[model samples]
Target chain A: MPTVHATIIARGGGSTFHRKNTCRVLGTPIIAYAIQTCQQAGFIDHVFVWSEDEEIRSIARSLGAHALERPHSMVHYYSGFATQEEWAAQRGRQIEVIAGGPGDVNVAFNCNNFLLRPETLAAMHCQAREDEAVGGVIAVAAVEPGLCLKTRDGSLFPFWNDLSVPRAEHPPLYRRTGVAVTFRERFRNGRMALAPFVVSREEAFDLQHAEELPLAEFYLRKRLGLLDSDRPAAGEGC
Target chain B: MRVTASIIVLERDARDGVRWDARMGGMRLLEHAVARLKGLPLVDELAVLTDCDALCDALGNTLACAGVPVRRLCPTCTTERFDYLTCEESRIRQQLLALEQAGLAGDVHCFGSWRLPLLSTRSWERMYHALLEDRIAARIVPLTTEDPNLYTPLGGDVASGRLFGVWAHPGRDRQEAPQLYRPAEACVAHLGRIRYPQPLTKGVEIAMTEAVTVRTAEDMPLAHFLWARQQAGRACHDSQDGGAGVP
Candidate 1:
């Protein structure tokens, strides 16, 4: 059987939402959700949390996940001048260094995307492992049509010529989410043939802004059955 | 910079079945559009571009009564074999030429009568200033929404049905995704730099509520509701300021 490894990348110093990964959601740290989900996933052989922050690493260790200390150089690999291929090459090298060696199958999860269920992760892993043609499987959500683009001379033009047509008849647009499963060889190749695993818009929500924290909590509470009207008030714990 | 505001009222089969003269908020939709443009201090001249003769006469009488200096222009180009967009483009070119010949210079801001009812004068002012500051040929208003979904273009390979390029990985701290900006129905263009078949560029972003364009009769109620809501908010704001009177 191929070894399925899950890596939850939680870096510190986010300008948008400070210490977002360590921030509590329904009493537990947000990063704990991804760690716990990976631990619960039967298909995943090992779970790792890659971060440079000592506090985040400590939390990962407490959550029964191996804490991989990320290098400073790896953390600052982003460059506006670098091409996509160059960035991918850099990413491949970084992953290889963190994982010790390129494993059989690698599943990546963003700590901010707390809504990702274990079942979804397992399914993605299975799909990536089973399909030879697929380089990787990533979550994507459908985008609505009837958008317009502005011309340089400031005239409005429709993305879809006819807004009168039924939505079903219009061409579909998909948005890529921050969750992916990749094979060892595909990860190193730089060029990946990604297959889209359709997920609901709610499932793909990433906790970025401080304003979104309440919404994320609401969804998490709803998922935990804490929001159920019939549930006993005293028994409620998420 | 001298600015000429053109209120474009095209005579075509409106998919929403709403005509330019349709009643909206106790006034004709065209009248609301005209009134909005007339209030803009930056605009040096005003012109109405339409195909209908009766509309010109009716609007002429109204403008004459109000003592506003206005120019009425009719497109001499034959509409035969021309689609809606092509026909509209032709009419705009004709109107711009007329304005140029009549000694009008600088930027020509075109306002579609359909969109003017909802857009605020503040938005127009911002667009004009942006145009001047940016030194760009035109300035457009982008429709804003809270939907956080970032999109990717579909690959041409129909058989595989795979997404084209490598996307932002989950490992990255700041995931960058391609943003699609939908244009709201308003734009300012410089007469000197005007080019046919203009390429798309970035525009000023506005709130989704403020970007509502009334396409059909069904959209009328929503427009009315929004307009009333805006008025109510303004009145409340005035009351809070101890009734300082309108600005």
Candidate 2:
């Protein structure tokens, strides 16, 4: 069997932005919570977290996982693909790399996404296992581009080109959820897409902003069967 | 010739102290040691070593009144630098030196304050065997229990956790780490520590279990410790070498 390796990229330093949101998990650093989820899935052969924080490294070690130190230059929030690429290049031994694409697939997840479902994972693994052509599965939620907009260079543009309508009236378009990314070995060779496998949007959610984190947490708590109805949803904007 | 073993209870923080300044302890530590030593048929004679002046005086008075001899040794410190060997070595050396200065000639055994439960008749036999008959390169024995405060909070409540053990070797220097003994493929005996929040077993239990024994300072006789030092000296040959012998 091909060894499955994962890298959870998070600085794990005390974040001024999401202090309350980040402090809820235990046994590992905030980022490692995702790494632990991967470890629990049994699909991962080796799990590593790329972080510059010594405490995070210690946390990973304590969790029985390896830690790859992210260089100072690559750790800045704006410095994107280069960090993931360098991290994958330096430490991608035997396992594949799943690079930047969506927040749900990344390490710093919302608190609500904690009780991730195994079937969703099973569906992806099934695709990867049966179809050699598919690199892996990327969990995604259907979104209507017209319902979302992107602001760049002090201007607002439609999130996707084909959707001419304003985003407020329409439902949100498809967004990739980072719950898990099962990649193939070939994907690490600079290929754009993985051996594609698809799963339900209900199995995924976005956790980009601080407000979205608690929503993810709330949903995750429900998924894990830990909470009952009437619990307030996590992350305000969600 | 009388064989007296100085069991030094060094200060848990210093590196070294004057021969008389080494022995330091209170009534509790000595009482525990004496209780553990009661069953040692071969011990012949034993003394407690401590550095605290008040502590030493009180312990000395207590032990003398109890009919067990006590003496004061130099001050020594405790450290976790390498399994606490530095602290163990200093205490052992201080006690030995105190015995020598007091004009008490005997084969003295030195122990640390933390080594209370490890000093029993069964352990004495094993140490004697390792030194005299077994002729083993190195023998590390296990302690009956681990520090409940650090490793196991409930004190062995978890059934399948790592088996806790202490190391024991005759003539091995406490300064040297266990890595040095790896070359000999040393013999290690794993002994379980009695569960915490409960009293320690009355004596060492030799029933079989799986554990690794490394070397600790509490297992050597004064003569063996002296021999180890001499061997280290011989191996040094030249003072520049700074002997790293079996001790």
Candidate 3:
């Protein structure tokens, strides 16, 4: 079996919420959940926290995971100069630096998504391994379909022909969950034939706002069986 | 500036053969919309645009009951039936032309939809003020905050099943992501400044609660619930103030 590594991308500074990776959700740092999931997965050989912040790295080390100091250049700040393809190439470079071997597989996990399950990670790895032609397998969540539109020059324009049609008849939509498994070789080459691994919307919830933290805590407490019929005491599980 | 507020009713607003007459909190959705617009002091004139004669009669009754003067606008189109998705812009243009012909076209035009019963008077004022600012042709209300990172197109690559053209922000921080504004239910515009194809636009951010737009039968309950909650909140505040009520 090839070496499978899980890298938790926990950047210290967030534009919306500061130090979100280290932000507490049900008494545990958000990054800890991703690390714990990776550690619990049977197929993953190593779990590493890649971050630019010392506090986040220290937290990762305390949680029994390897801490990698990510360079500032790899920490992407949107300048509008680089296209998305260029950003992908830069990500490929970052992956190559972390997992150098040809056969080694790197699983990228966003630390903010605390609800990811070990089974889901293992399933994605197994799918990627079973399909040799595929470069990676990414987690996607279904989006509620409706009448989508775009605005141009202060005017609304519909993407579809008939707005009178029922919303249920619209085609289904899915979005990337920022979780994936990529082989080292596939990262080196620009062309990656990626496969889709469907996940529940709860598992794909990425914490970006302060209001969402309490909701995430609610879900986490529910998962841990700490929640009762009545409202649980504040910091009960913590 | 002369300001004209138009309550736009389209055939597409019908759900289960019911038009904007759908009731919420014991009042028709159209009534709630008209009452809200009627309360705005910035509005110099009020109008209703629709092709349905029955809807026009209903609007006349609604306005008469409210004791507000309104110009009923019936925009004549070349096509017998206008498909909203395909001809929304043309319909709006025709409405504006009708307003112009009636000499009721104000320097500033505010368009309200009957579907948006919860859009607050404060939000309308925000857009109106934003439009009044120099060089702004249009002002629209946007959702409080929406992360662009989560969106993906409908389909993916045929062979690999990988989502193509997915734009993910490089940074984990959402602020690093591009700011995108999805317009809410109402729009305010300076009629003179608007150009043919494109116009300079500004955005006024409103709370997510104020952005409820009822599009389907399923949405009516949520709108009604929200309306009830607002009324309850207002009542509680009024009693707390010794029944003096909001100024």
| Candidate with the greatest lDDT versus the true structure | 3
Q: Model 2 off-target regions past 4 Å? A: A13-22, A25-30, A77-84, A93-116, A144-173, A179-185, A188-192, A200-202, A229-238, B1-247
lDDT of 1 by residue, A1-238 (tens): 6777787777766535687888877788888888998888777776878788998889889988878776555454464556545644655566566555555887888776778888887787777777767788888776656565454555455664353465556656666677888887865676467688877766787666664554566567557765433322221122
Candidate 3 error regions (>4 Å): A1-3, A22-47, A52-104, A112-123, A140-175, A185-191, A197-238, B6-11, B14-39, B44-89, B97-105, B114-120, B136-163, B166-180, B195-200, B205-247
TM-score of 2: 0.36
The better candidate by DockQ, 2 or 3, is 3
What would the per-residue lDDT of candidate 3 be over residues A124-184, giving only the tens digit for each residue? 8888878767788888776543222345644343332233455555544565776889887
Point out the worst 10-residue segment of candidate 3 chain B by lDDT: B78-87
Better structure of 1 and 3 per DockQ: 3
Taken over the whole model, the C-alpha lDDT of each candidate is 0.62, 0.39, 0.65
Model 1: lDDT of residue B36:
68
Report each candidate's C-alpha RMSD, comma-separated, in the order given: 9.8, 27.1, 7.5
Over 4 Å off, model 1: A15-20, A23-29, A79-103, A145-171, A185-192, A206-238, B1-139, B143-161, B166-202, B206-247
Query: Candidate 2 docking category?
Result: incorrect
Q: What TM value does chain B of candidate 3 have?
A: 0.80
List, residue by residue over A1-238, the lDDT tens digit for candidate 2. 4555556665554333443223453222345555567677766666676667776677777888777776777665445646545655655541234322222122222322334454555566665565444445545443322111212321112223222233334432233344445444445544324322233433554333343333344445445564432222222221
